[model samples]
Target: MLRSTGKHSFTKSTVIFSLVCLLGIALTVDVFWATRSSSSSSVYSSIASNWPREESHVVVLPKAANDTDSEETVDDKANRVPQRLLSATFADIPAPELEWEQMPSAPVPRLDGSAVQIKDLLYVFSGYGTLDYVHSHVDIYNFTDNTWSGRLEAPKDMANSHLGVATDGRYVYVVAGQSGPQCRTPPTSNTFVLDTETEKWERFAPLPAPRYAPATQIWKGRLHVMGGSKENRHTPGTDHWSIAVKDGKAIEKEWRNETPVPRGGPHRACVAVGDELYVIGGQEGDFMPKPGSPNYKCSRRNEVVYGDVYMLDSEMKWTVLAPMPKPNSHIECSWFLWNNSIIIMGGTTEKHPVNKRMILVGEVFRFQLDTKQWSVIGRLPYRVKTTLAAFWDGWMYFTSGQRDRGPDNPQPKKVVREMWRTKLKL
Candidate 1:
């Protein structure tokens, strides 16, 4: 109607009212679109995970023996994760290729156990079974057959847990360790060797003194043992000892005193590369059991987890290497030499910088001897300590340790028998 009378029908009040109505409609539409655009952007931001949504997990049920789903370890089409494997924090850096698969559970559950890999067989020595109850049997797993051989009885004098063990391909040499359990028990200097080829046991010259979880490795016709807790379980031992060995027999009658470690403690990862013997991780303090208490109530003292790394060179001199990314302990045997790099996985770390609360670690750390550098390469499904680790073929296998209770409660909770392996490019 205003279009036909546009020139003369316009009153001043009506024109003002029309203009006001038009402004109100425009503001309402603009506000509606602004709110709708904000809502849309929030849901679909730079990262799809920015908004809140129900998380769907790809649950991996414990695989049973004879389950054909083993191939699902890597090829599972149903695998779904809440976010990308690599974090946005990584920027454009390409992460190392890594994939982990849960293998069949170990024959038994134990920590502080000594594991040695032979040609095709894995020999697991005695260790603390349930609450300080030690198992003196050796459980052998044949990687070729994926079967566990019958339990082989260890030497009667062999320490039950915290044994310093090394393999010369066919022979596993057991060094000093705690005899029975923790706390009240004293360490044993008794040494024994098991010949995997002959299925025989032989006694060797003992260490000068006993140690708990001593850093042990075989290199250049010698077995070197260094650094561990003393008999009191709270004292740190820095002494190093070595003896000439040949074909499962001690060529020398006694262990010769060698160089001492810069920092001495137990639960450290020791690996021999060429002429260098590297010792990494371990602790500074230990729990002490009551003097005469029957229950063996241990007191957690000034426990300190450390990342110090020491290398014993061919010159028989001690040198320092790159420390761990974080303070980690209780990874004594959870390490192996892979492609000139020492790969260490899982341990306990100081959760708080001030309070020093211990928390279990689940990361795979690599120390390249050639570059003298440390890098975090991967992560495990869960955090664990004292995992018996060995590199077989191209896979890194680790099994049997105390699963993390939680950060709040750093105490040992569940000792798991689950075995896990990850493929590594050689």
Candidate 2:
């Protein structure tokens, strides 16, 4: 979150000048940040602070008046300044609009869902049914037939969305996440495993640090979950933990806490390559509960959506890696490895060039493991966030999540059931 400090006196003209500077930053922000950030340990935030606000605020600047007037009297008479207005536009047509492939539609629209591919089937787990309802069923899609073949019920006490899912190509693990609807809710520590071969679900050791959407991965025969929202939901947690597993059962009865991530937050990507574990593209702030609302309505506050990348070696030591071409978030489940590179699909950028709102990213990014470099490889058909992605044979397939309806919709409608695929260029 934007931790602002110190009071400063500003003239009306000075305030106007500051606003102009904020608006022009889009042109220089990349170069300015590049110098301050480096390849192995970069950090950044949405530099723009005058974004949207849930409620209007009164900015009382000191005013000049007759020399005889007291300083206190001038403060009382200062005029209020309306905040920078929100001037957002959208694309004319609906996005992720499907065409004639005749891909089968999912039974329901899901947001923030988790999925794992096993052989010819993709197992899609629980997510919010929409913005209000939570889903507890698992959907199975068969690639051999190109159809959603089956559905299974999840654990009785699993979070409906924001889960951390990892797989060993057979046993899929579902970790902590928020359990229900609304804001300001504590996340669940429940961890469960589903054995695909047997269609059986088993309970496992609970997560040591329950996170809203922690990055979970299986590296060198162990399960690691790291970096997500703490109990407060607004505060990011960097705590990391892991446990040994054999078949589908935990070899270790309890989790072992390891070195923490450099920065912590949800909506980040966790991928394992060789002896290293990498964390990429997450945000530090969240939509928080209002001061005194009856339903605990959430309001967007100051935040840091960053592309800083870090890697953990076999010795648990941290190493910085090249950051993304631009800051990205809401890509926790949308990253996968292909051709010795980590490919990230649609998500959101740090902030909009024209406004304070974070904008959906349409470009596809590739982080090359061999060269340790980042490049914009391609762009999505429609900008999206929290999309479930998988790479199979020569095709890149993705489904679910919110998609832009217009050219650049800031806030897209929640979730789509359509699935689309494109053959990778290789």
- Among these predictions, the greatest TM-score belongs to 2
TM for candidate 2 is 0.75
Question: lDDT by residue for model 2 over 1-426, one digit each (tens)?
Answer: 123222333355689898899878965898776654553123212423435543422232232233233554543334222233432221111223322243677888878888888887888888877656778999998888788999999988988888999999899999999776655467889999999989999998999767899989999989999999988788999899999998988999789988999999998999989998999989997776677866556677777888899999988999998887767888888977889999888887666433465577666788889999987766677788888887777777888888876664655665788888777774
Reference-based lDDT, residue 225, model 1: 93
Query: How close is every model to the real structure, measured as TM-score?
Result: 0.74, 0.75
What's the C-alpha lDDT at position 33 in model 1? Answer: 86
Residue pairs with backbone atoms closer than 3 Å in model 1 (clashes): none
Q: At residue 234, what lDDT does model 2 achieve?
A: 83
What global local distance difference test value does model 2 have?
Answer: 0.78
37 Cα displacement, candidate 2 (Å): 40
* Separate clash counts for every candidate: 0, 4
Regions of candidate 2 where Cα sits further than 4 Å from its true position = 1-102, 291-296
